[model samples]
Target: MSHTPAPSRYDRQPYRRSGRSGLLLPTLSLGLWHNFGDVDRHDTAREMLLGAFDRGITHFDLANNYGPPPGSAEVTMGRVLREDLAAYRDELIISTKAGYRMNPGPYGEWGSRKYLLASLDASLKRLGLPYVDIFYSHRPDPDTPLEETMGALDQAVRSGRALYVGLSNYSAAQTREASAILRRLGTPCVIHQPRYSMLDRHVEGGLLDVLAEEGIGCIAFSPLAQGLLTEKYLASIPADSRAAKGGFLKPTDITPGRLAALRGLKELADARGQTLAQLALSWVLRQPVMTSILVGASRLAQIDDALGIIAAAPLNDAELAAIDAALALENATT
Candidate 1:
């Protein structure tokens, strides 16, 4: 099938500057952390990628170890890029991360200079790109010196392998330290990717403040909390659900208390004329520091649902109060 990108793609979506940088990323970005691997059909992945681009989502996030077997997601993405999105490559913001285990050995993982540099090379090879728009450290390595890790990120940019550098899963203090090092190295950290959702508010405790102070952009991953914030898990976990499969989101994580909270949030979502997932995404985007929300989709409909968040009105003060009250109830029960 021939795929022509929507002519009005830019008109429908909103773009925000990434921190203090001149780069403007779409308000919503698609992540290839799930459902774009060798285990999945290539045609479906192609559809989702084209669908996202058509809907004005210019950013596509991936990691070195996104597939179940690891590295296959990038392979899948590479194919799609060549077959479908090659013409519009200049308009896209492609990002990939390193630091997790990609192969067996002392040098296969972490934030060491060797690991990061090698991993970026391997990621570029898999992605079939000369340079990714943003390359991230993926996570902090307590075993390695922060200087080494930050230096590797700086090198990635200086070497022209990545246009910008970012960090993920770093705490507030860690971000402050890393950003300072990157700044000194003459490669300022452009973005920070953290897990932010209604249920996961760790970023709010201090990370948001740190990013704001440092003028670093924030694009939150797991914005739907691995689909927990969605209505799919409201009544019961489907057999095909991520929780049922017992990987990152275990069935036990869905306790009775969580169910009750989901129910309350669902009512609120209904009242707001949105789905719980949209509400969760909207809530995260309400923060001015948030440049984008990274969402994963298993199907075209999921992508559509996530894109709807951009059009939804920001949650009002009364709605925010009600959400806080519901969360308080959830905390009491848990």
Candidate 2:
């Protein structure tokens, strides 16, 4: 008789190819952008991560400066990976960045070779991994030459510290230059992580084109506009919302006009029998160039909601037209 292994809980979420790469990423990726910091409960962070993976979130986004105390998120993730997720590391796509300030000296941050190499080492130590699947430059450094940063990223790949190299928060033109440098260094940039949402469509300005021309994947962050795209603020900011916590989401960003527009969006989402957060996420992953939507969840249930959005399917022309109209008004006023 043939033996059948028990089904893993992660058999649900759908996966899509990340750009033109050989790897396939889940449509929804969990990000440790906020609340997974030093101040948050370790158990809660682990639960959120475990719940996400169980629901098929194979990709996890983090940066060296992710914590309030800096590097705490990675340290926390390291514990979870060791305690519960170690055996499944091959199934995980872990990414970390290093362009931000991590130390006091000039060489301690930015795109210089010294900072990049050293920062990747520190991140690896905190992550407790031999190599991360993807290593990002975090952001563009104006003062530092692009070659230096790209070169360090190449070294990270060549030395087997990171398997793939990516750039984050870089402009369309900047990405063009960075790609050239990476190509010369023999490390082709695989992806570009950018902040994109219904409200923040700046990447649509031109960056998506660069990503396509270079065959790089686009992983969108803040697809829900830092919770502004969710029904959580349909009435008013709740006590536990990011705005209330004075974190990444700001109070001023939630103007009366924006709220009214969101009410319309909330109604639209209700008509589809889904939450505004789900719809907002659905909108981002709709694009062909989009590899994944990087989202943050404070609770396991929130992760459940995110995973539910992956199989929502394509939006019809009518829905797209309505979204375009509503978002046009919002953008005009912004």
Candidate 3:
């Protein structure tokens, strides 16, 4: 499909600086973790990509193992780049990650220098780009030494295959050590991706502090908690919902207490003139360390809803307290 992005693509939406880096990312980014794979409709994926760009979402996040079959999301993105967004390449911040199981054999996955570098090469091939704006180590490899993993990330930048390096799913201590290693190597870990949402506040425990202290940007993924934060599960889970599909989010995970808590959150969202998802997005971004929130969408409307938070007012102290009270009530009930 021929595409012309909106003339004022960067007008209203805001960009946040990634850590102390000079890079500025749109406050909201699109993640291709789901619904952009080979199993999904090509037209829909293409439409969402173009529509998002038209709405000023410049960053597109992907991982080597994002697709149901693994690596297909990048192929889909590559096709979009080649067919539609090639001329606007420099206007985009395309990122992808390694350190997940992408294939068989020991060298096919993990944080080994061999796996990390090799994965970047393959990701570059699939993305159809000489280099990605940010390349991440998807997770910390237990067996692989941290030095080895960070070394590969350093190599990625030095080789000009990636402009900057990032860490994902790393703990607070791990992040601190990794940041030091990257800094020593002159790469200075620009960003860290962690699963963060109202439903999941694990990052707040210490990871956010580490990122803040290290001056590394935080781009939160799963900000909707795999769609649980939305109204999609207020009453019943949709037939096509991720929970119904029995993967990362299971139907059993949505209990009555959780539903009740979400309902309370919905009330707050309604009062604030935003959707529950928007409220959730705004909540995670309340942290000063947050550079961006990665939102995964199955349709154009979902993209619009996530973008809605960009204009909505940030949650005030009273609203934040109410959210906490509701969550605490849920925990007590459960």
Task: State, as a TM-score between 0 and 1, how close model 1 is to the true structure.
Answer: 0.98
Candidate 1: give the clashing pairs: none
lDDT for model 1, please.
0.91
- Candidate 1's C-alpha runs over 4 A off are none
Query: Which of candidates 1 and 3 is the stronger one according to lDDT?
Result: 3
lDDT of 3 by residue, 283-318 (tens): 999999999999999899999988888888878999
TM-scores for the candidates: 0.98, 0.95, 0.98
Q: lDDT: which is higher, 1 or 2?
A: 1
**lDDT of predicted model 2:** 0.86
Per-residue lDDT of model 2, residues 116-153, tens digit only? 99999999999999999999999999998888789889
In candidate 2, which residue ranges exceed 4 Å CA deviation? 1-6, 331-334
Q: RMSD of each candidate?
A: 1.1, 3.1, 0.9
User: What are the Cα lDDT values of the candidates?
Assistant: 0.91, 0.86, 0.92
Instruction: Please give the lDDT score at residue 316 for candidate 3.
Output: 93
Put down candidate 1 lDDT per residue, 181-243, tens digits, no spaces.
999999999999999999899888999999999999999999888999999988788999999
lDDT at residue 242 of model 2 (Cα atoms):
84
